[model samples]
Target: MNGIELIVIAIAMYAVAYKLYGNFLIKRLEVNNSNPTPSHTMNDGVDYCPAKPPVLLGHHFASIAGAGPIVGPVIAAGFGWVPVYLWILFGAVFIGGVHDFSSIISSVRHQSKSIGFIIQTYIGESGKKLFLLFSWATLILVIAVFTIIVADTFTHIPSSGTSSILFILLAIAFGLAIYRFKVSLTIGTIVGVILLFLCIFAGNYFPIQLNALTWQLILFAYIFLASVTPVWILLQPRDYLNSFFLYALMIGGLVGVFFAAPSINIPAFSSFSLDKVGYLFPALFVTVACGAISGFHSLVGSGTTAKQLDKESDARLVGYGGMLIEGLLAVLSLTAVASMVNKEFIDILVNKGPVPAFSLGVARFLNAIPFLNISSEAGQTFSALAVSAFALTSLDTAARLARFMFQEFFEVKENPEKESIFQNRFVATGITVAIGAALTFSGQTMSIWPVFGSANQLLAALALLALTAWIAYLRKGILFVMIPMLFMFAVTLTSLGMLVITNYNSENYTLSVISLLLFLLAVSLGFKTYNVLVNGKETSRELI
Candidate 1:
């Protein structure tokens, strides 16, 4: 298969899906901008504040993105480009789009609360607790995984470190300039984009070398601040700008694929069982979560994006369109590896990591363009740094989402006057990041990646179960939700069971036990959702 054909097919499918299937979701959700969203109803300036759809899309897309689309697809190419390709294309449209769009709408209807709240309303109080515990722990793993990824990126490509720091400082000023002050979006964005380009150029010229451990510590401290601060102050603006980096990369990559017309050297079907991940059946599904469907997207949609959504009408673009855009990225990531030979692919995957394989592969794609005049070394560095910067976006966003889960977990619903130390955002955030930081040293990044992927898919299953209950409450079509829910549950449970046995034999009891816990949580939630949908009283009520 040619990379260009893959790109073309992906683009067409994604566009059609966003429009046709997106309308189906809109009818079920029954949304309108005429109605006030949680962002307006519960405007708290910090976590809950209305944002323009474009800016929200940028932030939402960047948050759920990071390196997942690149790293996962690049690594999963080992299984076979064809399988990974098919899954990313159809799974993203049918499964991922539905999951993300419904999650946002569910949260919006419930005053932009987390998925735990949706479960609590449709399921039971106990179910909510289980889901929150499951969700919070999943988020911590996300933080740990991303922290290690970003740190390692910086350690190897020191230019990424310099670029990231520059981004942080620039994002702060950009946020205040456009949002706080009276600067027009046009003027502010113009200056901010120019500065962003300068940051990229500066990164290549002046690099700051640091070890992985030191980078990890610095990242922990940075996320601590990023989480506690207001959304617009740092995260929102930073991610908004970060989206441009990704958009440029995707566009350039597509153009490169067109010009290069690279024939895939890797087999369309390599083996049923991939080299490291063993079985392809469930491993490929879990490994490619972000590119296809991810539980983490639910967290971001409900935890942060729902809270900031300007209107119900914008949900389709931010939620549904975001997933399609990401699917395109996953296709590009796979194309990166498909263009390489088995020897080069294995060497990069085994030696460096997924990011570098994607980086080097994409650099070659760009090199095929005659007019741009990009060198291999410079293009590769740029690709790696861009990925690392987005990975940093995931690190802090996970911390904030984790903090939200922690605070919500401890809330005294019965007695509103009751107070606890856990209610304090700083305390909750500190505890969250502290725990994630601890896990960074617990295992190597590569060792942790597989478990992280499994746990993430498991979380998605639980989230889908919760979404099914919500759809039942709405008295809408539950078939769409139900199918994906069951399929992911089957895939995740089998994968986790495999991990439990695999890790236990390797004497990795910690990860083994963690996998078992995730398995238990999914089963518990599935039962709860089942009982609610079948045994509970009629759910049709005034909810909008």
Candidate 2:
């Protein structure tokens, strides 16, 4: 099949989903534009300030889109693009989109509480604690893995290092302009794009190469600060600005696939042997988590995006739209790799332990742009910078989410109670980043990616279960959410069981234990949440 055909079909499916299924969710959720959102009701300058849909879209998309779409599909391509493509297409529309949209709307309804709090309101206190713990661990893993991922990208490509620094500086400037000087969105976006391109130019002229360890330390410090700062100061504006690069890359990829019209060179289906890429049953589903459905989206959607949402109606756009776009990115990444990546480079990609495999795929896509003067090396560097931008957003956003969970853990109810030094945002953020940094420094993050994928999908299943409980509480239709939840539960639990066997064989007892624990937590939580949905009398009455 032609690569462009793949792109076209994916786009068509996403469009139909947005029009049909997305609208169905919005209506089902009863998104009332007249009702005040938490952002408007609370209006806390730090985390709860109301944001226009467009800006929120930028932040939501950038945060959730992180290297997952690129990295997951590229790694899963060993099973061939056909399976990956099918999963991305169907999974995003039916599973991921629903999960994200429900999480956001649920949070918005609950005054922008995290999914853990929503679980508490509808499920039980015990389920809430377990879900929050799961969510926190997932966010910390995100921080550790993404920090290493971005640091490795920067270390590998000096130009990306230079460009990443420039991107940060530009984001700060844009934030100051928009928030302090009250710059218009149009002008701010224009300035941001101009500065972004300038960063690319500056990157080539003044590259800053560093060792991987040094980059990791610096990134840890950067996220520590980024996490504590007010959202308007960095997180929102930075992600909004960084999103331009993502949009450009996605659009460029589609255009390249269309005009270049590359043929599918990779196999449509590889053997299901464990040696090649594990069994297609669980490994394929787990390895390709983000492109299809990821539980991490629930963390971002409830933990941050809900706080900034301006309208209840916008949840459909920001939540469902973001997943579809990420799915499109996954499709693009798979097409680029399947059609263009050389056989020899696959070994290098596996050995080198960075994102350059996808970078090289993106480079080929860029090279196909009509009349573009980009060299292979330059295209690779640019792609690296773009992916690093994604990693950067993911690391800090994950850090921010971690901080939220930490504070939530303490259950500090008021401003006076939160005055304790330990409750300070910096302290919370510092503690969160510290744990992730330790894991990253130990070089354990990469080894745990498979397990992380399982945990992530499991989180998605749990999130869906939570959503189903809430829908049941409201006496609303929940078959949509419940079906997807069951599917993900099966896929992820099987993946976790397989990981237990693999980890035991490899003598990685820690992961083995964690996998078993997660399996148990998921099953127990599933049984409890399902009972909450079934036994209506048992539903928690203390809720928003």
Candidate 3:
């Protein structure tokens, strides 16, 4: 198959799925916007604030998309593009879309609390505590690594550094105009988007060079403010604007594929070239989790998206639709590389990394434009800037989500007293980002990252369990939720088991022990979930 055919089929399938399967899932949730969302009912104007569908969708999409869809799909293409494509398509439409939509709706139904709190009500207090602790730790790791990554990118590509600083300023102004000055949405968006392009051009015209450490420090300060301030000020506008870069990139790739008509040069069904790539089953599933289904997406939904939801009905668009959009991006990423032969793809993969390979692929795509006479070098730079922007987006979003998790973990459940310091948003955000920054500068992110990599899919599996438990508690149809839940559990456990053995054999006892601990966490959660599914007649409200 050629890249054009893949793109066309993907677009059609995703559209149909959203119209048909998406509606079915929406009906299961019994979505009604009649009741005020937490954005209004629990509105504090900081975290809990309402947003229009476009704005929130942009925020949600940019937050979840990150460098993940680009990087994950590219590497998972090692298992072969055919398998990668199918998994992304099926996983997003079925497993990922359902997981994201269910999580958002469930959280919206429960006062826009984090999933950990939801698990507490349905599963047990112990479950909530464990999940939150695990999530918070993972998020800190995310914050640290991405901060380091974005900083490195900025140092290497000083133009992106210049663009990013201007980008943040532009987002803040856009947010202020829309929210504080009460500018109309249509006008604000027009101005914001036009200025966004200008910012990109400005970066290319006049680059600003800085050391990685300096860039990292600047990012730390930026994220600290991004986390503590109202979502309206920075998070919403920045992410909303950030989406345009990705949209443009995807469009360029698809158009290039259409015009270039590149055939799939990579072998199709080579899911397990054991010497080149590991076993296909669990490895591909976990590696490609971001574009398909991610446990982290659920956290973003419950932690931030839920709080900003304007209506119950918006969950379908922002949650399910967002995942499918990401699916397209995964497809685009796959197409970029799949168009190239195995030898050339592996050459760049080994020499530079997934990001560069993706960048080069996209460059080829855009350079296919004959009329415009675009250069591959320029296209690569454009793609790199977009990657850096999203990576920075993920870093800050992770910090804000971590702050939410940390505060929720510590807040008094039956509070009848004054708020504690830990519950204070400023204090919570400060501590969360601080620790993450410390880890990045201290050179400890690499070792702990492998642990999180293993735990990432495990997190998804546990989240699916929580969603399944919710379905069982409702006495509704469980097959849709149950099947995916089981598959993820098998994938996660198998991967973790492999890690345990692999690490133990290599005498990397720290990772081996940590992997074992996570293995146990998943097991405990499974038992609690089983009990809930079998005998969960009591209301979560009553349990609370």
Question: Which tens-of-lDDT digit does each residue in 1-544 have in candidate 1?
Answer: 6999999999999988888899988987788878899888888889898888888999999999988899889888988799999999999999999999989988998888899988878888898888888789878878888887788788877877888999999999988987789688778878888899799879869999989999999999999999989998899999998888888888888898988899999988888897677788898898898879998999999999999999898999999999999999999999998999888898989998898899888898888899998888877877877787788998889999999899888977687357689978999999998899877877754565667787788777877888888777766778888899899999999998998999999999978997898788788788877777667763443323
Q: What TM-score does candidate 1 reach? A: 0.96
How well does each candidate superpose onto the true structure, as a TM-score? 0.96, 0.94, 0.96
What's the count of clashing pairs in each model shown?
Answer: 0, 0, 0
> What CA RMSD would candidate 2 show?
2.9
Give the winner by TM-score.
Answer: 3
Q: Which stretches of candidate 2 lie over 4 Å from their true place?
A: 274-276, 341-354, 412-422, 538-544
How well does candidate 3 score on lDDT at residue 437? 83
| Candidates' C-alpha lDDT | 0.87, 0.84, 0.87
lDDT of 3 by residue, 269-352 (tens): 665744433588778887887889888899999989999999988998999999999999999999998888899998988788
Residue pairs clashing, model 1: none
RMSD of 3: 2.5
lDDT of 1 at 175: 89
